[model samples]
Target chain A: MSGPDPERFDAFDARLKKAREQRQEAPERGAVDRSGMGTGLQAGIDVVAGVIGGLLIGWALDRWLGTSPVLLVVFLFLGAAAGTRNAFRTLQRLMEEGDRR
Target chain B: MASPLDQFIIKPIIPIEIAGADLSFTNSALWMAISVAAIYTLVMLGTRQAALVPGRLQSVVELSYEFVASMIRDNAGREGMKYFPIIFSLFMFILFGNMLGMIPGSFTFTSHIIVTFFMAACVFVTVTVIGFMKHGLHFLTLFTPPGAPKAIWPLLVPVEILSYCVRPISLSVRLFCNMLAGLTMMKVFATFAVALGIFGFAPLLIIIALTGLKILVAFLQAYIFTVLTCVYLHDSLHLH
Candidate 1:
């Protein structure tokens, strides 16, 4: 609701962002957003999360529509894309922050 | 027996037809409005009472805030904080859309290729502009992998261009297809669970498992979309 805070990210580069979310206080979201190997790990997390989310609705729809897998397939890809995209942004943000300083 | 897919259709409440184009606003529009309102209210309500100890609602709100904020911090950095409005808004939008679709008789716009594609396109185009603006034509260098032999430039360049152009298409289709397919399978399996009488419990159980997974997917998908935007932004700005 409120505008975002205008602070830059932490001092760590891709490495620290992956090693631990200490951020100095980098939470899971922050961890995922930061670059490094963490992005890959987070990307996997993203896909699984999406598939889980999609399956629920797909089940409900199948019950309603009598069509299976259509929604499941569609939403799964959606989740994967969503996950990959998130990782991409996190990597860039970290790089940019490093460059800024 | 109404087909579930029928419900996904975008029928116009207020038809807008122009020059052989049908860009009508439908119940989907109504639901989209509702989703936005619901997300805004819940988030604001959650954050409005930011607590030291944290209330139940506030905790959940904080989790989301921290989750997304951490994501930006992790990926975008302190500077990425500047785009919080866009990132946060985008996350909430996807989250609400996904969650709302989980409800019965709801339209899953994200399941539609057009909708997801457009959303992805926005990220792709915006990131490109940011890249060009920030780094000038040097961003073009992103097409060339650093270690590639110079002789292969003619081949690799086209492939790179193709991949870059396909970003939004891949991004959007992935979301749309995943959502649509997942939703469709769940619906179909549910029918089996019911039609098989007591034996339907197996499918039902599977569906239940899928449900839990889907919730994770909802948040993950939103996170993924936003983070990708950040990554692309990073690439654009740091092309070298």
Candidate 2:
């Protein structure tokens, strides 16, 4: 078969380029971007869970060892520290993810 | 008006007690079974044709597969592909569970801490086991943070270990609380919409917005849960 007309081929190529540009410029509607609220909620929960986990461990150890409130007090602080660390790490990861996006 | 929390109450459908153990199939269990059945049907429908050019159902299946596959590659690296089956199953299960729960009267099993905790705990155990298996005794070195002064080892080590232990708790609580809070808030707003009568339009509008938000939250929570699991897997697979 004879080659297609040059003018029509050029027009089609330009149209295809424009469509590709538009697709690249616009965000993908199907893939929802991570929201600030979701990230914030996650960070907050991470901190809280860290604290809770530490407290539980401390409380259990204290009860088992019959140390009364001494170990409990120490663990409460350690748990808070751990929780803060986790929250800090979460925020850091969020920043890294944002950079990647 | 029924209490907003009433939606969470588990009532036994088929109560079976054996030797003082309560083996009851409740509404929660029923919904879980329904979710599983719905997922199975969708996957079966999507894959049965196996067309070269995918139809609508096949497109959905392919899209989800690509989504989780990319998510795994991005978060967990190439080696993590081995665990794709478990990760994909977890994602689909939670996604379906959350979406189904959005139905007006469906049970949200994910809202329960026990269910989420069990899943999270399993992931934690698996990841830990994999780390130990791969690295042997070297896995213990994971607790020692990189570039820390040797002097503060005592303080930092405990903190690091505690934070590591915090993974499962954080994972489970994040999902459970989101579902619990979203559902409760919607139920409360729904009650207001009913009680307001002539001025019900206010809460009615809020409920509409909240409904949309809850749907987004449901999907987001599932995505985050899977992503975090991948992250944890990545950490175990490659230290630091």
Candidate 3:
């Protein structure tokens, strides 16, 4: 049995191509609206993750060194700082992408 | 009625023990294998006939190829295509895994923190190794932000290191939480539907709506994971 007709196949291909192009253009216009909430959530997670990671590492170091509260206190501040910086960076990147678009 | 969380139970089909290790093949493993097999069949068989005028499956395959190709090009540049296979495989695996999990009674490996963390860790390690290999000790300069004063280097370095160290954690948590939330919501609604008996119409409508949302979330999470991987690749390769 013969495959699909050549002309019919070409017409279908053209329609698919058009649809794909439309999708491609749609994202550019919708990027901010689409990712607004997602970006905010990601930034929040980045900050939280940074702080928790730092706290864990610092607490472990304090336990190992027998320094008790000193290292923990220091690391807590450091972790907070790190978390803030990460949040800043994330927002910066989002802004840059928005500007680029 | 069965507990909603019972869907996630990893019951072993063929219990096996090797050298005192519990290496039994569980439901999660079975679903993972199913995902891989499905992807293989879709791509391999779908594109077997490379016709100028393609069929539906061939169009899907081609569109995915172009989608990922443009992603890499736009994010990581031409040099990044060397890692295309890894990125493409990652995207397809997660995409298929997420899509498959939407089916009732199937396991979602991506919903597990351990699995997502493992994949994130792999990406983190690979990117770090690539950075070190390409730039030698200069890669250490990644910790130092440009235009920062030398006096503040000591303060900035630790913060940068801390942020960098938490990448895998954040990446894994993002995917895990999203998937778990979607699955849990569906389960809760399903429970409501059954419990509501004759007045189950409202819960049924909500469940239907949620299924559509879950499908969108699956695609979005997969896309996000792949895009982040590309971003990491770009950062490591260019030191930006």
Candidate number achieving the greatest lDDT relative to the actual structure:
2
What DockQ does each listed candidate score?
0.04, 0.78, 0.49
Per-residue CA lDDT of candidate 1, range B174-233, in tens? 567557877887888887887899899999999999887676666666766777777666
- Of candidate 1 chain B, the 10-residue stretch with the lowest lDDT total is B158-167
lDDT of 3 by residue, A6-79 (tens): 99889999999999999877646422144578878888887787778777888999999999888888888888
lDDT of each: 0.70, 0.91, 0.86
Better of 1 and 2 by lDDT: 2
Q: Which predicted model would earn the best DockQ?
A: 2
What is the descending TM-score order?
2, 3, 1
For candidate 2, give the lDDT of residue B212.
94
Model 1 lDDT per residue over A53-78, tens place: 45554566777888887866655554
Better of 1 and 3 by lDDT: 3
What ranges in model 1 sit over 4 Å off?
A1-101, B14-23, B49-53
Q: Is candidate 1 or candidate 3 better by TM-score?
A: 3
